[model samples]
Target: MSKPNVLLIGTGGVGTIVAYGIDYAGKSSLSVVVRRDYPKVKDQGWEINSCNYGTIKGWKPAAVYESVSAAGEAGVTYDYVVISTKSLPDIVKPEVLAEPVITPGKTVVVLVQNGFDLGRPFIEKYPENVCLSGVSHIGSHNHNGVISHIQTDKAVISVFENPHLDKDFQVEKAKEFISLYSNDKNDVSYFEDTKWYRYRKLVYNATLNTVCALTGVDTGRLDLSGTLESVSIPAMREVVKIAKADGVELPEDVINTVVHSDDGDWFEPSMRVDVKKGNPIELEVILGNLLRVARELKVDTPVLSLLYELLKAVQFRLKEGQGLITVPEKRPISTKYYS
Candidate 1:
């Protein structure tokens, strides 16, 4: 199997995990982009903590670029570019991020992040066929440059028609990716139902993440038996309703299936991680999206609206104590959520 040259744009937990997965696959060459002080970031090689790879030794990437422009200028090319940036609005913009991060090689770009709209900007930037939409179930915190893998369920994905894949074997590429994560912990799988998978994930994040963000509780601590029944379960069904209204074909009970099992407890969500790290909350990433969808579909979501309000309220209270606006904490909501 010929290896593909890979360029990863972000160096957060997800980026580190993907780098490990790609290296293990032995079917992809990997490079990860760090910030201005490449020397500083590179000084500390990646320490990945996964059951599959244990507290393994650090592995440096084939190439490291401080910026995409520098990598492009340096004549480094890639067959695929995986974007794992978390904060969408700041990192991804029209002017700063409009340039194609991937070169005109055998490059097929995949966007790995939370939220359905996370890849919307990429889809807008590139032709649909050239882009692949994906979601990772791994959880981690950047514990002093080390990626501590909290939990990993599956790598779920739905392929969009990205123009770049024409030069490559699409199934071959996906299988290569899936094989990389065929460990006991995380399994990568591809589904043809891109829209459904997308919405289904939205259901998972909106329920798991939004509630966690509001309550400031990790999935490990919460008693979700009741949440799975009344709050989370109903909210998930409501999300499906909004999706169907907006023409997203999702399964009947994907939420109940993927989220609430008879497990003892769960893991910390990215939203909660963002809060704990004192980074701006991803309210838009989890809630504002469906709000937009509700507007488009004219769906009513009272429970979601209340959740939004409470999330905003908590964020406001926290930011007030911190003496800053606190990273998009302005809930700025009302009963406007139509489904």
Candidate 2:
């Protein structure tokens, strides 16, 4: 039997682990799509220090392309197209981002990004394809070409409910993916339904991620500053409420479980890291979409709404810095606001 062909779209912290796990499994031939670091990565490869895989000096995929189109043009129909990019629907739609490599009825679209309803656009766009939505619980980073994996990878993967594909077929596809993705130390579990799982994770992401970014604190300091109890937990409750209203019944102790899921270590969440680096944080898919759901479902989210509004201002500044949008000086000027 021939090895399955996999195309990875992102090479960030999470993407590195996704590639490593798949490659470590040695069950599939993995290719990657890198935007700017293709030349360096192709030549020098990566220095990976992982908790699960120990220390790998230099590592690179079977092939690295400049873009998804380039990878697609290679004429190999990918068995799995794993996307681990930031979920910024306002910047780029999920369907549009993955459209270039999709093989209609043959390819399985695996979304390993954050945010709610991550697979909806893919299912709508490619009705013939199976979409496996996964929630990654790992702490890792890619600094330059050196990849550091601090936490062991624990992923929960589930097949999105697709009316076009048979239920049994979806399960088989998900199992095949799990087999190709799981290794000795890294744990990957398959679930029948992941909507509840996504919501459960939002209890962590939508709260700690936004709060820590806005407040400029790591998880430990945030907890030490009494924000975890007074602010983080309250925000988490709001997410649970919204989930229940959206017909996803999370456990009563879900918030507590998420709060203590990790030790109160001095580490920044991904959103906070993005904010500190002057990169645009994932606002829309992370909180904006959830807020929209709250509004439709009539679930009140004062904490999340306030965070969203504040983050919108931060996003505006980020956009200005990135030259995505220009702020007109004539519109309004307030030096005191910065102070």
Candidate 3:
């Protein structure tokens, strides 16, 4: 049997890891869609220093495109389109971003992004297509086009099929995609409850990621400064309550695990790194959408609400400073949320 033709979008730190995993599996033909870094990655390939896979030098996909449009123009329908981009719904709708490459009933779109409800748009757009949601607990970073993965713990990837589509074919497709990440060093598991897993991972991301970004500190510093107990723990508890209100029963010790979990001391979450680098952060999906659900369910989330506001401000400032957006001098602002 021939290998599957896979198109991997978003070549960030996590994207690089996913690409490498697929390449290491050697069971698929991989094509990548990149933005600004397209030229560099296409020219020199990727230099990865991974603790799990060791060092990989000059790794290139089977093909590279600047955008989904270019890939679509190439007239190739991918078997699987794995999106490993940040969940910045405020900037671009997920459906719109994936529009060019998605072949409604033919392609399976797997979302490997952070935050919740990211798969909804794609699911809504292509009910016939298989949609898979994934949560990653991998530690890696990209510096100067070189990815450095810290293997302090086994990289855990939990994936699940969309509950809306209760079909055996969808489940099989999810399993097939999950198998791409199955190696001795990585732990990739398939679960029935994608929402529960998303909220469970949110317990870690909504707290650690938000606090670290706000304080401009690393996870180690946050833990050492007692902020994990005072701030991070409370924030995670709020997430639990919100999750419960949304009808997901998280583990009882989920808060404790998030607060005390050991992924390494100096690990810097994607949000913190994005803020420091003045790039757009995944504020809406991680915290903003969670807060919206809390409000809809009448659940109190003061800690999360505060984090959402602060992070929004930080995102606005960073975007403005980077000249990514223009700020009106005296325009009337609306209180409506991005969602």
Q: Candidates' lDDT values, in order?
A: 0.67, 0.88, 0.81
RMSD of 3: 3.8
lDDT of 1 at 198: 71
Cα lDDT of model 2 by residue, 56-143, tens digit: 8768889889898899899888999999988877777868978888889999999999888777778888999999988888989888
Which is the leading candidate under lDDT?
2
Cα lDDT tens digits for candidate 3, 98-177? 88888878888888888876766777788778888876667787777889888522333433455566567777787888
Candidate 3 error regions (>4 Å): 152-164, 218-230, 262-268, 328-339
Name the runs in model 2 displaced over 4 angstroms. Answer: 220-230, 261-264, 332-339
Q: Candidates ranked by TM-score, best first?
A: 2, 3, 1
Per-residue lDDT tens digits for candidate 1, residues 1-339, read: 566677777777776777677666665677778763366567766677775567865567778878888766767556677777775452245214525455443466777766665555555555433566667777665666767876764577556544544524655565555665355445778876666777777776788787777667766455544564567667887898998897786766577575664256667776776677666566665687678778777899987878877877666655555565544558656777689
Q: Which ten contiguous residues of candidate 3 have the minimum total lDDT?
A: 152-161
Instruction: Enumerate clash totals for all models, in the order shown.
Output: 12, 0, 0
Error of 3 at 331 (Å): 8.3
